[model samples]
Target: MFDELRKALKDWYKVHHRDLPWRHTNHPYAIWLSEIILQQTRVDQGLPYYNRFIERFPSINDLANASEQEVLNLWQGLGYYSRGRNLHATAKCIVDNYQGKFPSTYKELIQLKGIGPYTAAAIASFAYNLPHAVVDGNVYRVLSRYFGIELAINSSEGERLFKTLAQDLLDEAQPALHNQAIMEFGALQCKPVSPNCSLCPVVATCVALREDKIAQLPHKVKKIKTKQRFFVYHLVRNAKNQLAFTKRKPKDIWEGLFEFPLLEFKSEAEQITFLKDKVQVGAAYKHILTHQKITAYFIIDNFPAAADTEVIYLDLADLEYHPIPRLIDKFLNAHRHQIFSVGQ
Candidate 1:
């Protein structure tokens, strides 16, 4: 059954696989960039980032020499800022220790920053044709449904089972082609929602298809409750046409980014009195992520030229230099008139 499924997948992939840029190159640096950029990001969204990264850092040495801020700037709109930091750190390690060459072995790749088992396997197979199984979200979904596996993907048992199965089914003769075929089949055919089973090459052999339970086969444990957060941003402007912004530290989300001074509130109604005492409210916006919802309040303050201030101030002209969050970008667009208005 495994051999039949593999042959079907490979045949279909030969005619229908996507012509992604990374597929054309066997360079480890390019493959690593694609893998990192594609993490938690769609191919359409990640493509531009991948192109930009390759254009900027054509070589591992180039990435190693680049500053953290520059790398973060290129990765600004892409969330998961830690991935960029990790990529930079890993590049530096490669340059310093490996003489600007990516480690060829899967074990050595895993030891590098941000290169986990999945990433290391992907690089090894795709770049070097090494015998390593690449198991990612798409692979898990595809395999679980195809085999009617009941293990929770988040469980330790599930991880072990899938890894063993993936390794067992991998085509040792053509590791790169086999890895790409499985991943591409998963992404394009055995999708998370409304998979095109009718057109799938291996649908006849799929256990979930035979049982008419595609969606329910790959079960996961109950999801954790997402936390709610509130942010009050003081958009204070002084006589010199300067705005208030501060850099987020390394530990927080959007690290190394800049934003208006923020005061977090536990709830919406609780912040009214706090804002009333500090500054006048201008606008409010809500930004949602996978695990957090941020209710942001935008406050504007115009003070006398002589009023002493304690907030970090930056000239409006320098706003481009700072890394503001998308929520703050929306707020700025909504209140552009007041910010650009002629008044001390």
Candidate 2:
């Protein structure tokens, strides 16, 4: 059954796979860049970023020599910024450690920082044609539905099961082609919701389709609990109206990105009374991340700039030059006048 499914998927993929740029080359650097950019991102959304990275850093040496800020500058609008940071770190590691050569096997690739089991398998199989199966969110959905496996996809046991199954079904004679086929099949045909079952190549062997359990087969036991945080950004400006900016500290969201001087409070009512009386207040802004819901308000302080030791002022013209988060960019775009307004 698995053999037939594999053949059907491969044949279907040969004719149906999207003409992605990264698929054109066996270059490991390009493959790694594409995989990293595609993490937590859809193909349509990640395609442009892949092109940008390739255009800017054509090779491992090029990426290794570039500054982190430059890489992040290119990755400005894309969310999950830590991937951009890791991409730079790994490039430098490859240059310094391996003399600009990417690892040829999954075991060696996995040893690199930020390269996990799934990513390592992808690089090895896709780039080097190693006999390793790459199982990610898409694979989890495809396997659970096709095999009628009623296990939580995020669980340790479930992960091991699906990985073993993916490897068993892989055609070792053509590992790269088979890996790409399965991944593309899951992405285009057996999607997470409302998949095109009528056009599915493996529909005859799909258990969930036959059993009418497509929606519930791929169960996830854990539910993410989002934290609600309230932030007060000090929109301070000197007499010259240069906006105050500061780089975020380590071990937090947007770690390396720049932001305004921030004061976190328990609630919206916990505003600083004296500061409120001194400066004009802006409207509250909401920013959402993977597991956080932030309710933020701007403190438009002008007369006296922030007295904080870490605060550094940026000219209103230079605000866009720094690698700030998308939320900050969004605020700046809407409140350009407020940021440029003359302070009394």
Candidate 3:
């Protein structure tokens, strides 16, 4: 059954695979970089960033030598800034410990910062053609539906079972192509909602289709609880018409990103109380992260330099050089005309 499935997947992939840049390269650095950027990110969205990184860094040594801010600046608006930081850190680690050589084995790749099991497996198989199977969300969905497994994917038992099944089903002789086939099958054919079951190569043997459980198979045990956060950002302008900005500190969201002076509130009532005396600049902005829902208000303020030494003032024209959170960027883009004056 696994052999037939593998053959069907390979045939389908040969006809249907997208012409992505990553697929054309066997270079471990390129593969590793693409994997990191694509984590929790879609291919279309991550592709440009991949191209940008390659153009900028081009090599592990270049990436390792580049400043953290440079990497973060390029990674701005991608969200999940830690991935950017980790990408930089891991590159340095590989260069420092391995003397700029990309690790070729799964074991070595996994030890690097931010390189988890899935990423390690990907680089190993895709770069070295190692026998390790890549079991990501796509693999989970494909396996669960085809096998009609009802176990929650987030559970330990389900993880082990699916991973084992994927390994057993892998075409070890062509691990790279096999891994790519299964992932692409899940992404394009066996999609989460309204899958193209009609064209699915394995549709004849798909257990979920026969059992009428395509939507329900591949369950997850954990329910994400989104935390609510309220932010009031002060767009403080000094006498020079320069804006005062603060870099978000570490151990928090938007770390290393710049934002207007911020005051966070515990509740909407608290936010309302704080806003009563202050005037707002624009409509409130709502930003959502995987685990946090934020409602932010921006307000205008005129002041000399504040007591906080961390505050850096920059002209509106010069603001383009700084990296900021998406929310802040949205506010600035919307209010750019209103905020800026005629050339002085």
What overall lDDT goes with each candidate model?
0.85, 0.85, 0.89
Better of 1 and 3 by lDDT: 3
Per-residue lDDT of model 3, residues 26-100, tens digit only: 999999999999999999999999999999999999999999999999998788999999999999998899999
Which stretches of candidate 3 lie above 4 Å from their native place? Answer: 224-344
Scored by lDDT, the top model is 3
Q: Write the per-residue lDDT of candidate 2 for residues 230-303, one digit (tens) a residue.
A: 88777876767677788888899999788888877776567544346645445778899999999877766532
Per-residue alpha-carbon lDDT of candidate 1 for residues 170-278, written as tens digits (9 for 90 to 100) = 9999989999999999899888899999888887788999988887968788877888888877667766767877777676678877888777778877876667755
Clashes of each: 0, 0, 0
Better of 2 and 3 by lDDT: 3
TM-score on alpha carbons, each prediction: 0.65, 0.65, 0.66
The ten-residue window of minimal lDDT in model 2 covers 300-309
Report the alpha-carbon TM-score of model 2 versus the true structure. 0.65
